[model samples]
Target: MQRRKVTLKLYPNAAQSARLEAWTRLHCELYNAALEERIDAWHKARKSISYYDQQNVLPQIKADRPELNELGSHALQQTLRRLDLAFQLFFRRVKAGQTPGFPRFKAAKRFAGFAYPDSAGWRLMQHGGSGATLRIGTGEAAMSIRARGRHRFGVEAKPNDITLTRRNGQWFVSVTLRVPESACARRRTGDQRRGVDFGINDWATFDDGRTIDNPRWLREELPRLAALQRQRARKKGSLRFKRLGRRIARLHERIGNLRRDFVHKETTRMVRQCAILATEQLAPKTMSRSARGTVDAPGRRVRQKAGLNREILSAGFGMVHPMLAYKAEEAGTRLHLSNTRQIKPSQRCSACWELVPKTLSQRMHVCPCGHTAPRDRNSALVVLIDAFNTQHTPGTGVAARPKPLPRQRGKSKSVTRETPTTAPLGA
Candidate 1:
């Protein structure tokens, strides 16, 4: 059994919407209050507060604040659990020699939502189609919400857990259910092994020279986004300003949805087609790091670098690797990631195995050995070559290819492109 989470967009009437907002506010308050208790206990008496230590006093808290009773105990406990997890992560990061950002109190608006740990507080009603009805709480206090979304697999087992989340004024219920692995398996339609290169301009470039054009969603929406920002800047605390903020939020939500939808579809395409996949081990965080140096020495091309970072982030290429990984598991496809820094696929020649450095603007890969192709295609080839026929010699950073490997049985064989081989001509 695999745990699959299905998120459904919820449609609620005015009363239901009000109730959700109230519960969300209550959960946020509980989280903040619990955080305060931990801080005070630690500072005043040098005492550390555990989750159960705070949980044991919940009954008294509910009694003191009767309003919390309507929110359900399981959901309230999950809020405390979230805080405990936050602290746990902080401690773990500290022990790992990383920055341990202490947990800060979240405003009610910042608190997205809350979770129910188990079947106690929620129930899902499936009607065979894509849609379902989610019932929260029980008896007279039960709030039945109409959920609209498509489920990939049949959810027959009891719900593992339920989380109610609010994103940009929209309510979503993500239900985790235990489903059969067979039902979750992806169907493969193609047997070709391929390497993929993700880019900021183009979404993906395959070793075969086929390109999936980048939607450039953020770029297309920028004009309207800029206009809205300009309007909001003119009035800091006005009714029109608040309305503009909501409009901006809705636009952001739309952009996010478009990106997610495209990613899922494209990933599914790869999962269904390729039997073996190779890609670069991209580090988006390192690539998009700020270029602003300290006062002693300032950075060059700050605005240009900032714009490049935005483009890198907007492309959402980092999501491809993880998406391919999980989808590979379901499709029985092999996924390999070549070391980006060491291999330097973008610079290394796939044919001669020599370094062929080129500027970012130069989209064509041209080598002295008469090997040439699109830069991205060559990069994908380098990645694929590294995955199969090359290995680095000990104590040396250079990778050595013993011999040429057999080509993949792909749809279109490359007659024009040079295959990565160390063998002599006509050998």
Candidate 2:
């Protein structure tokens, strides 16, 4: 079965909203109390508290605090389990020689929300005309929230888990459903294969000489954001401060949403059109690292580097690649992450397969062999050709063919040796 998650915005009445907040607060307290217990136990007895030990005490805990009994048992258990997982991660990191961040107490704001491990405690209902509803809790404690989303899950699809979260004063539920893999499978076959070069000016340039312009959403909103921040700075602790704070958060969220939406649409279109996709494997973290130097030594182009870092982050190549990965898997498309060091897509000419050094300021690629093209597009073509260089023979300029497919009992199919068709870099 394939697992898919869909988040739905929830609209709860005043009473229900209050109850949800109360539930969130209780869960926050419960999580902190558990973390405190572990710290205390380890400090006093030099012994670590295990998940099973905590799980065994839940019955007594509920018996002592009757109020907690109102919260579903599974939800409470899940909270404790989350604490246990945190500790497990901490210890794992310690063993791996990484920073072991011990689980700390959570403020109500930080807790976000809780989850139901299975469909037993909650139900999702889809009405023909009235949209969807999420029913959480049981009997008297149960509340039905009007939810906004297309009901994509079918009757046969089972809800495996559900999390109710509060983000920026808004309630949302993420439902994880288990459905047959075949149901999620999309057979998208095509002869068209393409490569992409990612950049700051154009979000991506394709080998076919197509480009998606970078929106620079954050850069565009910076002036308005600065104005709001200035207003907020002057109105500290006042209602105006809180209002502006929300506005700032919403603006940030809007920019993020816009970038995500743009990437999703572009990636989906690419995956649908091509059977195989190729692009340079880039480490955005290393690329976006700060150019600041120590107290004694100053880095060159500090301000310029900072500006470039912001552009890189706003571009969000990290988010784009992962999104493309899963989408390509579902669409039955092959995504090839070419090694950038070996291929050197940006430094090599796609047409003559010759080294052509260019600086960041150079927007066009010019080769001595009379080959020229837009820099990013030329790089994308280099990546495309490199994708087919299976022999890894440097400067071969020969495109390898796809391996022959299997034969069926009564049908004969020719092996496809057709390579990716791209325009000359100069063209």
Candidate 3:
């Protein structure tokens, strides 16, 4: 079985929308109250409250607050579970010597969503390919929300979990479904492998020289976004400021949606065609680090570096490789992640296997062996080589193909190679 999440945009009448807002506000209040209780318990008695301690008090809570009876008991419990998970994460981070960002009370505006741990509280209907109908709670008082989305979950989609979220004044319900792998299978006889290099100028450059141009969505929208910010600053705390804030949120939402759509389409196509997908393991956080140094020392071209960082992030370098990985998994294809530190793809010449280091400004990779290509494309070629090398010799790249166990299937064949499967780095 495989898990897939489907998000549908919800359309509700004024009455239903108003009720949803009230319910959302209640959920936010509950979250804040629980947070305050935990803090006070620690400060007053030097005691920590567990999830079970709070959960045991839910019935009394619902009894005292009659309005909460409208929501299912399961959902209210899950909200407490969510808070427990946050504290768990905080502790884990502290143990690992990382900053422990203590869980804080959520403001109503920031608390955008809540989830149903199971399918008991909600039911979804997909009558056609274009849209869906979602009913939350039970009986006639239940809210029926008309939603728009083409449901995709192979042959059959079995909803296991659901969440209702509001983003940019739009309501959306996300359903997590369990699907059978056999039902979703699409057979392909492809035996080819391709390496991809992601960048700022071009979205992706395949080892074979094919390129996808970066749309630079954030860059294109920056002028209007900046103008809106300036106007909002001028009208701060006024009604106009709130309206402008909505506009800015909507614009950001649109850019993110379009980028995700583009990524899904492109990745689906690539996964379908290639048998093995090899990509560089890029650390986007490290690459896009701020150039503004501390007070002791300053950095040069701060604005230019910041712009470059934004461009890199806007290119979806972080999103693409992960999408490729999961899509490849679904397609039963191999995904190779070459280590950037060891492979040094950008510095190595793909043609001659020689180190030809170049700076960020050098867009063309020129090698003494007469190999010349776009910097990103050449790096992609090196990644391809490392992938093939790792296939024969593991540990050469980030995640090499796993060696099959002898007992699981049968005895391993004793076929031997006469020469080296692939040349060494310096050879």
Candidate 4:
């Protein structure tokens, strides 16, 4: 069995919405109080407070504040569990020689959700098709909410936890269910293999001379965002500014949705065709650093570097690898991350295996042995070749030859464009 999460938008009436907000506020309060307790206890007595120590006093707390009793005990306990997890992560980072950010009290904005860790306090009253109804609490405080979305899991799937989250004034419920592996879509297998190279202008380049164009949604939306920011700045703290802020938020959400949709479709298609895949290992965070340096010594081309960084991030370079990995695992495909340092795909020739250095401005791979192709495409082929060579097995290499795309007469930019080709599974 594997766990899958399905998120659905919740539609609550005025009263139900109020009740949810109240419960969320109570949970936030409880989380903050718990964090304060731990900090104070440790500072005053040099002692650590375990989860159980705080949980044992819950009975007395409820007696003192009758209002909290209306919220489900299971939900409150889950909030404490979240706090415990936060502290655990802090300590883990400390042990790893990383910055140890101690868990801080959560404000209402930070604590926008609560979880039902078990099935005892909540139930999925009606679930099917495009919608479902969720019930929480009991008796007088019992609340039912209508949820809208296409849930991928079946009724037989066991729901392990339900998390209610509020984001940008929208309520959503995330249901984590345990379903049998057999219940998932049929796993695909194939002999076809390919290599992919990620880039900013073109989303991805394949060894077979095809490229996926980057949508650049963030770049397109930035002008409107800037305009909204200007308007908000002129009327800060006014109703007009608040309204513009909401508009900006909605635009950001739309950009995210568009990026996610494209990534899902492209990755799913790629996984189906390539049973064995290869790509250069990348560190996006290191690549997309701010160009502005600290006081002592500043960086050059600060504005230009910042623009390049924005473009790289807008292309969703970081999200692609993880998406491919999980999808490949589900489809029973292999994804090999070739070491960029060792292979140096961009610097090496795919055909002759000779080191041919090129600057960022050189978009064409011109080798001394007369082998040439688009820079990204050549890099992808090099990645495929290096991965196969490193493996200690025969008959595991890809058969497709990298065909160099035709370049424009005046410049090295390739004029040739080809559509992405996907092979049928088991072909």
RMSD of 1: 6.9
1-427, model 2: which lDDT tens digit per residue?
Answer: 8788878889999999999999999999989988999999989999988888988898999999988887888999999999999988988999999989977889997789999998778999977643798988888878889998754446667778999999788899998989786677545645477889999998888998888899999999999999999999999989999999999998998899898889878888887777777787788999999889878997889899999999999998998878777777777666666666655789888877767888999999999999989999998997777666642332222223233213312332212222223222221
Task: Write one digit per residue (lDDT tens) for candidate 3, span 1-427.
Answer: 8788888899999999888888888888888889899999999999999999999999999999988978888888888899999999999999999999999988877888888999888888887776778999766669878999865564486989999998887799888888887655545446567888888778889988999988888988999999999999999879999999999999998999888989888888887777766777888899999999988999889999998998888877788777776676666666677777756788988887677888989999999989999999999988887677666654455233244324323433222111112222222
lDDT of 4 by residue, 354-396 (tens): 6789998899999999998999999999877755554443222
1-427 per-residue lDDT for model 1 (tens digits): 8888878899988999999999899999999999999999999999999999989899999999988887788889889999999999999999999999999999999899999998897888876676788899776789988988767775455579988899878899888878887887888888777889999767899999899999988999999999999999998899999999999999988888898889999998996887767777888999999898879999988999999998898888778777777787787776667667666889988888778889989999999999989999999998777655432221212233454223322222121111122212111
For all predictions, the C-alpha RMSD in Å is 6.9, 7.5, 7.0, 7.2
- Pitting candidate 1 against candidate 2, the one with the higher TM-score is 1
Runs of candidate 2 with Cα error greater than 4 angstroms are 128-130, 151-153, 187-190, 391-427
- Show pairs that collide, candidate 1: none
Kindly report which residue pairs in candidate 4 clash with one another: none
* Candidate 3: residue 81 Cα off by (Å): 0.8
Candidate 1 Cα deviation (angstroms), residue 332:
0.7
lDDT of 4: 0.79
Q: What lDDT score is found at residue 212 in candidate 1?
A: 95
Tell me the whole-model lDDT of each prediction, alpha carbons only: 0.81, 0.80, 0.80, 0.79
> Which pairs clash (backbone N, Cα, C closer than 3 Å) in model 3?
none
lDDT of 1: 0.81
**lDDT minimum window of 10 residues, candidate 2:** 414-423
